[model samples]
Target: MATFTTAFPRGFAIEVLDVYSGPPRIAFKFRHWGYMEGPFKGHPPHGQRVELFGVCIFHVDEDMKVDKSEYFYERGNFLAGFLSCPVMRGN
Candidate 1:
């Protein structure tokens, strides 16, 4: 998280879209917006804008400490936006 924050020093924002809590478990859906100001995934900052949405699920132990976490997001969308790739046409 700190690495990403440092990479996008110009702007970075995360908006929580939804959250669900259950005993020992929690889930969060969020949207992330960032502007490239430094290197990311071997690509130097292009001053491009990137937006993506993802979900994070967390499992907590009896002691209320996070034991596990998972994240899901679309790699293609992020790469396309960040690299300014041409849109693909469906067959």
Candidate 2:
């Protein structure tokens, strides 16, 4: 979590696309975005916006609290965002 903050210090945004409710499972699709204005790992800030699209499903207890969560997304696409900037290309 802290690593993400260092990578997108301005702010990270989430947009919920869809949701399904169930006693045993709740699921949703989402879009997440933020500007890379802070250093990530050893990479310098690139001042570019990065976005992630994915879905999450949660299993809940009888008390309506989440007991487990599963997340699905394209790992390559997410990592590519970090490398797409000019700084990474020696430009």
Candidate 3:
């Protein structure tokens, strides 16, 4: 989380598109938007805009406390976007 905060100093935003609840689990489909302003995953600051879709699932116990969470997103798309930045052209 801290890396994200530093990487996208402009801030990141998530828009929930859909949500589903089943017993003790809740799932969400969302879109994320941000700009790369700092190094990320060893890539230098590129100052490029990034938008991606992802899904997250949260599991809660009987006490209503979240015990686990998982996130899924397209790595290819994300890496492609990062590599597309003009600043990454030489490398």
Candidate 4:
């Protein structure tokens, strides 16, 4: 896991309504954060072993309402970089 600082300047909680994978917009339902953390090992076309820096999912409703989101940042802006980090990404 990629260790990162926990001090994010702009703290927010979000809910991801969907994530678009591949060519078509394949509608997906709520996926638990626990299920997404990866020490995921596979050959990605990007051609490198990249550990997931945690997940940051943002969801906005049809009425433009923010549901919930979380930013488990690895390399992030400002404050978090300065503060201590608790969690990390899997390798």
Top of the candidates by TM-score: 2
Q: Is candidate 2 or candidate 4 better by TM-score?
A: 2
Residue 16 lDDT in model 2?
Answer: 88
Candidate 3 residue-wise lDDT, 1-91, digit = tens: 8888888998989898899776489899988889989887677877878888999998989987889989999977766768865556874
**Which one wins by lDDT: 1 or 4?**
1
Stretches of candidate 4 off by over 4 Å are 1-55, 75-91
Ranking by lDDT: 2, 3, 1, 4
Clashing pairs in 1: none
User: What are the TM-scores, per candidate, against the unseen true structure?
Assistant: 0.66, 0.83, 0.73, 0.23
lDDT (Cα, tens digit) per residue for candidate 4, span 6-55: 21112223344555442222233342222222222231122122222344
Candidate models: Cα lDDT each: 0.76, 0.86, 0.84, 0.32
Clashing residue pairs found in predicted model 3: none
Q: Residues 1-91, candidate 2, lDDT per residue (tens digit)? A: 8987988887899898999776689999988889999888778888888889999999999998999999999987777788866667777
Q: What is the lDDT of residue 82 in candidate 1?
A: 59
Q: Which prediction has the highest lDDT against the true structure? A: 2
How many Å off is the CA of 42 in candidate 1?
5.5
lDDT measured at residue 39 in model 4 versus the true structure, 0 to 100? 21
